[model samples]
Target: MHSRFLRLAVAAGASLGGLAASQAATIGLMAPLSGPQALVGQDQVDGFMLALEQLGGKLGGQPASVLKEDDQLKPEIGQQIVRKFIDKDKVDAIVGLSFSNVLMGSLPRLAESGTVAIATNAGPSPLAGASCKPNVFSVAWQNDGAAEAMGKFAQDRGVKRVVLMAPNYQAGKDMLAGFKRFYKGEVVDEAYTQVNQPDYAAELAQLQSAKADAAFVFYPGGMGVNFVKQMSQAGLLPKLPLYSVFTVDGTTLPSLRDAAAGTISGAMWDAALDTPENKKFVAAFEAKYKRTPSEYAATAFDAANLLDTALRKLGGAAGDAKALAAAVKAAGSEFKSVRGPFRFNNNNLPVQNYYAFQAVKEGGKVVMKPLGTPLKEHADAYHAQCALKSLP
Candidate 1:
């Protein structure tokens, strides 16, 4: 009777272990899902969900659950959502921390709890530098990277005097700083408008009066659409030479369309990239959603792949934050990114190529044609300031 009881106990323990090993991961995905940024958030959600569906509704060969939250473009709301995910939902990981400000507001809790958070959109300068957290990873480019590319392109193209404009926010400041870093020419005027201000008449008038050879700006989502449209209406687009970053990409292209023609922008990835992985992703995305995937979508898609590879390395155990972070670092080197070349810097931000693109009429449609690569295998300016020592 004792021997029979011992055999039953051992069998029960083994079954429980198997169940634990096969447990599904839970991911909390936060984004600005309403107001001006709704489309941006939808693209992120769609891209991630598409990747999840393609991966057989599993991450790392185990079923996964994704809890979606809308930050509404507010930092306070974002922090609350993060707290709920960590405290109430007990999520294994968090993705899509929205824009830079929201991400900044939520970072303290994420760092304190050692929760592995991946920012598919925001890569704030502070996080990339001295305040870098080992558990936080940004699958997207540093906020400055694309703007730096445009600045370098403008400099190379002999655009000596330029006006700089952007929404007054963390990303806006970072974008202007990045542009100045590479462009050594004179800045005619630096104008910062309110976030989602809807109108750019005053800024456009100021820009026109500056008489700068070109204009450089960083406006994403609806701001990009509105700004570019207003610029076109003011007859400054094709005539004045506009150079921008994150202002003429897939996210705003549909709205801007021909109005954005002749605009030159810089970014890490575009649908025009001639890579097999990118082609497949773009095709699948358009087929499923009937729209071109934005850079946000591409980054979030890559985030899903990165998470899959990481969880697979840990045999689906995402509960262990330190172990999961290590796995994510290892996976970064292993996963084949949809973006041409991608790897993580020691600061856990991306090291990738930045390209210059010209939006022009091709086949009677406005397309972002690849002009050149201004920065290759580029690491962020703040990476050197990071103190995390483990990653190579």
Candidate 2:
């Protein structure tokens, strides 16, 4: 069943690519188009395409064209795509990077070229730390923020002996480290899985034996769907509570369906968030795509909105890439984000709310419902380390 779902995801992604090719502002998207992680890349593409449609096929009053490429979730492929976008397509900006390793490979090139790189995902800690650059910005939460929120929730709920799991990558390590920063309870076991491992049967077996009260994981894209399905099949869904970050969202929720019911995750946005901006976005998204928008969709929407707002400030003349980049950095809080009141930190990462969310079947669809708010008006710990005082 999981294999069939993955195949269908790839097919859908190919169809979306065909649709994007028919349109004309040449926005470049680099993601794992083929591999174990393709489902996540597909989700990022879907969310970003939806944002483009919402903008009426124009950014800064010019017709939009998207140049989509398959990164295959490999760093080398990611680097190649950035070169292709910059050298060949001359894309105005780049967006929708799903993995940290890919971003690490691509960011330096984008930064050195002074090209705008608005990440719809992949907020690795290094980008928010010493390696921070002016040309790159993230529409997503910093790698550690969501996990820290989950950890805080676990502490508040008095969960002891939590099991931890994540892909062995930069963002994964950062996520676990951030969780530990807030969660002081005993971690029964800490397991690092291969980045693209398809099956989790052995890991699930070990987890059952460990008898942890709760589990925290940072499996994104296809891994999240596979892990949750195997956990349900293993009968661990109800027996042991599971808490996760970036595991159960728009991308994986549809594939998991009822299997994801009762699973808890943490994030800044959900489909059911009741706010004026979110309502408009959710309603339009569902009306157009006949599916509920995930947090990925919201973030992608913000990315497009940010670009549009920035270009508008520049009077729709995007000829000077350097001027546009500076304009975007200066045009703060112009776009109405789905998450309420989001702003860039000194590191060019987001300072936003973190909410604890649970998967619940709402009107026959699995939707993430916010349970408790964790960080209100939160700033990442690394913000104080940044020396920039004047607005970017």
Candidate 3:
């Protein structure tokens, strides 16, 4: 983030890696800090801090200094934040973004800056395809990848005539289109609601009339919180099996409580996943944040760790953007990710397992339970479109 002054309080509580150290690595975090999406943005900041704490406040044996800023959910403002980080702040690397709309204005600048941009979330299709670059990588699943897994899972369950809904945006369309790519059943009903809309009653009624065997949605943040609540109150919560991608997550589950119970959603990782790395991460995150880690947090944690791996490889070769980019590309699998197996594809996207998790009661609290892997070691379809040469 560019607003180093505004976020002094946030950094004060975070582990200060190089406050007294001479050699320091600077990283900037840009996210929506002052808008309706602040909850998820704050989670992004917390996830990065948790990873920093685990590293003993250092990245690659050097004190890591972080600058935090809020983009206010505007693309133009996001562009300014990235330019400020690159030009004025002179960050060694950049991380933390939540939306493609915002990234669209900032990502190209990273390509030119030669700075490694490790995306914690929001892997837009263009970045994974024709616009792919060596300096850019994603620790999160591409927007379509998890949705593809969810769509396949629904088909495997023998469900037919699935209804689909998402916000009328690039990511939303990408999610639904990704689902349709793998779903074998007919999409008897499909709808795109206004972004950040408060109520989904009209959409729910249409879904009920469509008589689909199941439904999949892609609401995120506050929209997810409101949509699930409205769905439960409409009494359609029991009418048909519901499935989703990015609709029900750790960020939204607490608000959903019993409403999201029994709902199945596809994700790259869940808190209950069976992996040594995931076990440690979930335990540490819960201890630090006092809340269960969501896939969003897991990805952001992995993003920071990924930078740690690359920066560590650079060791004394700090500030060498080209060399750093190469190291970051090669160090893709250096750290054990909470998602278990994570590696960069030809387009710098992750190729990993996607799981179907069902919301269920655990000790009187709603939690996501891993059902099964819908797609194992899955790679994005756009990887082939990327013309980047293989990394050495």
Best-fitting candidate, measured by TM-score? 1
Q: Judged by lDDT relative to the true structure, which candidate is superior, 1 or 2?
A: 1
TM-score of 3: 0.93
**Full-model lDDT, candidate 3:** 0.79
RMSD vs true structure, all candidates: 7.0, 6.8, 4.2
Instruction: Give all TM-scores, in the order shown.
Output: 0.93, 0.90, 0.93
Task: Please report, in order, the local distance difference test score of every candidate based on alpha carbons.
Answer: 0.84, 0.77, 0.79
> How many residue pairs clash in each candidate at the backbone level?
0, 5, 2
Q: What is the Cα root-mean-square deviation between model 3 and the actual structure?
A: 4.2
lDDT of 3 by residue, 1-392 (tens): 21121111111012334443233555567777665576777778878889988988777666666667777767887787778767865666678755878776777787898876777778888888999988787888888988999999998988889889998877888899899999989999789998789988889889889988988999888888898889888888888888998778888998899999888999998888999998899899999889987777888788778777876786634567778778777778677888888788888889899999999988998888888998999988788899986655
In candidate 2, what are the lDDT values of residues 2-57, reduced to their tens digit?
11100001001222245343343556666677876766666566666777787787
Query: Regarding TM-score, does 2 or 3 come out ahead?
Result: 3
Off by over 4 Å in 3: 1-23
lDDT score at residue 96, model 1, on the 0-100 scale: 89
